[model samples]
Target: MTTTNLSGLVAATYTPLNDEGDLNLRAIPSMVDHLLAQGIEGLYVCGSTGEGMSLTSDERRAVAEAYVQATAKRIPVIVQVGHNSVREASQLAKHAQAIGADVISATCPSYFKVSDVATLVQTMGEVASGAPELPFYYYHIPSLTGSAIDMGEFLLQAGDRIPNLVGLKYTDTKLFDFQHCLELQDGRFDVVWGCDEMLLGALATGARAGIGSTYNIAAPLYRRIIDAFATSNVEEARRWQSKSIELIRTIGKFPFHPAMKAILEMRGLKVGGCRLPQGRLSKADAASLRNELEVIGFDVEQAGGLAPAE
Candidate 1:
């Protein structure tokens, strides 16, 4: 596997949909353009933000293809192929490699929790082997996967077992575990931070990159956090991070993903609301969300560095 690791803000992108909740593949190009304009360094398609688990296998592949094609190599597209089935996840991985995706990531099967590090490693190995040509990142999201196995142990054992295994997309709030994984094997793994609000803490713990949902709406703000931190301006970095927390909290007041899609719609992207269970934001809720965001001084136009639409 290539030794290159993801750096900067990688957006765990949204799966654009129509009002009917069908894949609006046509919207992907503009969505990608918006992200690039926002200074997103990479794209993580079909992750939690993208509602990957909620989609069918075919739908997932189509979404992955649309993102890869839209990106057109301007930046790396990391496809998250995690599924409830290991075999299906592997098939998706193979498809991702076939379509020339830069990297592949997968969460362990969640319906039946992976019992230990060995099972987790084996499960991931089977998935990663499907795309042996690409680097593999095991998505460590304990809250969603219900498998809170120690990542340090998993990585240590997986290093030799899975030849293509590279790093993790750590989404938990555990700073010490994250730090240990980052420093393990003398930083052998590319541990991209996944908690948006805790990014400042991750940076303090030596995170070089972050992948998250909030980055889709506010990459410029997070970029400022990174820049300030790199320049040793801790106070400024904390200020930006606090703003991020405010934004996230405001959105969290409603159905988080649907509210995020609504924010994107306000910004002029036709990204419809999320799929079932997560559901859509009501008209009233959307209006209230807009008001809340305004009260917080969130400039939808300037949120991602986009110029106001004339």
Candidate 2:
């Protein structure tokens, strides 16, 4: 896969669904437009925020295709195709490439632990082989995956084998290791940070791009942080970053996925509730969240409405 580095805020999108948890294909267009209006740099579809693991492979494919079609190449779409079964991930990657996805990413198989670096590399290689023309990114979120392998070392060992191995979605909070990964091969990789609240810290450590679930609804706030940092306004950047952290904390009071969906609904897009195993927000809770958001200055009209980061 040929690769390019992406910068600024990339929103890890939610998979829109109906009340019955079925795919809501019609929601994609408006969702795309909304994100664009919010100044998101790109979309990371079928990842954790999108409930990739909860959806069937067929559903994931449909969601991926829908997002790609809706985006219409306005911004790059990075589809997460990781699965416990290597073959399934490869199949998904093939579909992503076939549908014109800009990039492909995969998390480590968490069900049956991948024992060592070589094995992990071999597994990811199989998935990349299926789509040789697209840039491949490893999604390293150890909290959920529990693999906890040294990411910097993983890159050193696997970077050469996976010909199109461009970089990773580094979600762990290990700054030392993260800095080491960025320094690898004289900083050849595109190591986008994944922690939303700590983005300022990541930027200080040299992260050029970041992907986060909150960016879907809070991109404008973060754009201020990025801009403030660019202009060396540490105090202003800190203020926005603190506000983002507070918003996340407030939203955490409710069931995570449902509350996030509700926030979007409150913002004028009724993309609907999450699937089974993930609960839904009540009208009362949605109203309360809106009130809290307003208190925190989550302007629906201006949410993520800043100019795109240069």
Candidate 3:
């Protein structure tokens, strides 16, 4: 099998919107610069961080297209096409393919739920069929989808059926299943880790690529963690990873996406706040979060300088 390796930091990017909650397509250029400046390898757009489920299909397509065009093929852009409806997911997948996204990923249908691994395979198979030529990854984020089908079992059965099945965006805490999926078929698939706080642990267990929300602001720190590990500086890696945990713990105090967008704004990105259902941080709260992040050693200016050498 010819495997694809999407290693290093693949940021699950936030969809930039204006204060009015409309798509801010112009922000894509700067967003791309911010990510590239940190030496981030690629982007996972319209995923959980991008609030894929919250937007309309047309909105998702516009967001995906902006990212793709802004990137101009500089790096891989994996567009999350998952929806509660398989047909909708397939349509998004086909749209992603048409827009030149590097890969397409989908989570399980949460409302109806996949009754079993076979059903999940069928569900995902339909979505993947839309973009038959593109690599497909199952976004196994059971926390949000609430469909905790064993990934190992899913892969075992689905691997043969989905011709474009490449791997999974392993987001659940099931390290055992993650390892099983990683080692399965002699590492045939790319199992990109998702949980930011447990990233070091996942790296220890053979996770090469990682996708997360925090990567949008903290890519340089995580890149250092990866670099430290590469040089066998385990202690140094642990220190950097610890900072990541602290950052998440602090930001998670508010609504996660809103808090994150606040941080980006504080850093001068102006990516705007989260839409309703995700409330915005007040001026006081935003100020406090900024102080907390600064105390944690996040230097907005220096982040770009910390990117790994090419």
**lDDT winner among the candidates?**
1
Query: Which digits, one per residue and each the tens of the lDDT, describe model 3 over residues 230-266?
Result: 8999898888888888778988888889998887887
Tens-place lDDT digits, model 2, residues 1-310: 4567989999999998887778998888888998998899999999989999989999999999999999999899999999988899999999999999999999979999987899999999999887889999999998888898888889999998999889999998887788889989999888999999999999899989999999988888898999999999998898888888888888898888899998787666757998778878989988888787777666655555333222
List ranges where model 2 is wrong by over 4 Å.
300-302, 305-310
Which candidate order results from sorting by lDDT in descending order?
A: 1, 2, 3
Name the 10 consecutive residues with the lowest summed lDDT in model 3: 301-310
Better candidate by lDDT, 1 or 2? 1
TM-score of 1: 0.97
Q: What local lDDT does model 3 show for residue 67?
A: 95
Candidate 2, backbone clash total: 4
TM accuracy, model 3:
0.95
- Report the error of model 2 at residue 213, Å: 0.8
Instruction: Provide the lDDT at 66 for model 2.
Output: 97
Measured by TM-score, the strongest candidate is 1
CA lDDT, every prediction? 0.92, 0.88, 0.86
Clashes of each: 0, 4, 0
Q: Please give, for residues 1-310, the per-residue lDDT of candidate 1 as tens digits.
A: 6658899999999999999999999999999998999899999999999999989999999999999999999999999999988999999999999998999999999999998988998899999999999999999999998999999999999999999999999999999999999999898999999999999999999999999998888898898889999999898888888888888898999989999999999889998989999989999999999899878878775555322211
Clash number for model 3?
0
Q: Rank the candidates by TM-score, best first.
A: 1, 2, 3
Question: What TM-score, over all chains together, does every model reach?
Answer: 0.97, 0.96, 0.95
